[model samples]
Target: MKEGNDDEIWELRLYVAGQTPKSVQAFANLKKICEEYLAGKYRIEVVDLLDNPQLAQGDQILAVPTLVRKLPPPLKKIIGDLSNTERVLVGLDVRRV
Candidate 1:
């Protein structure tokens, strides 16, 4: 894994409808990826759409368990449980294709 600058923090937002199996898995997978690759340079914000449905509009989210890379610029979205590490890394711009 490449080391990120300590001055730059990664902001990640995860949108989920509820504590569904997929949502839970997504969080787990994302956490693992962040811990392994980003380590101390990442922040994860979990937004439950079931609690605040309107929040989805901000990111134009249409699916549950969607991950939005809010920081590091060029915002990105990935929809799924995030079990695929390689795809998530590429989607988050943590790795080049």
Candidate 2:
């Protein structure tokens, strides 16, 4: 399901405190975005801080429901439920084609 000439895989890391409403929404929004824009070229790794708090330190995540782009270099981060598709795409610097 890969698309375009860009063969670089998108490595996304989602950090959440627990199964709270915000965390749930973030995951849903992220999933939808990835499916639409990234499709099969992306991989999402969800990390629950409540289960393993130490994981947050690796990404320097200070807030819950934070999305971190671990690959494609220049690591990018977005904080929120990710309901805003345009902002998320802009923050990730992902082009729409």
* lDDT winner: 1
Clashing pairs in 1: none
> Candidate 2: which stretches are off by over 4 Å?
1-5
State the local distance difference test value for candidate 2: 0.90
Give the alpha carbon lDDT tens digit for every residue of 33-83 in model 2: 998888778999999998999999898999989999998787999999999
How much is the lDDT of residue 38 in candidate 2?
A: 86
Instruction: Tell me the whole-model lDDT of each prediction, alpha carbons only.
Output: 0.93, 0.90
Instruction: Give model 1's TM-score versus the native structure.
Output: 0.95
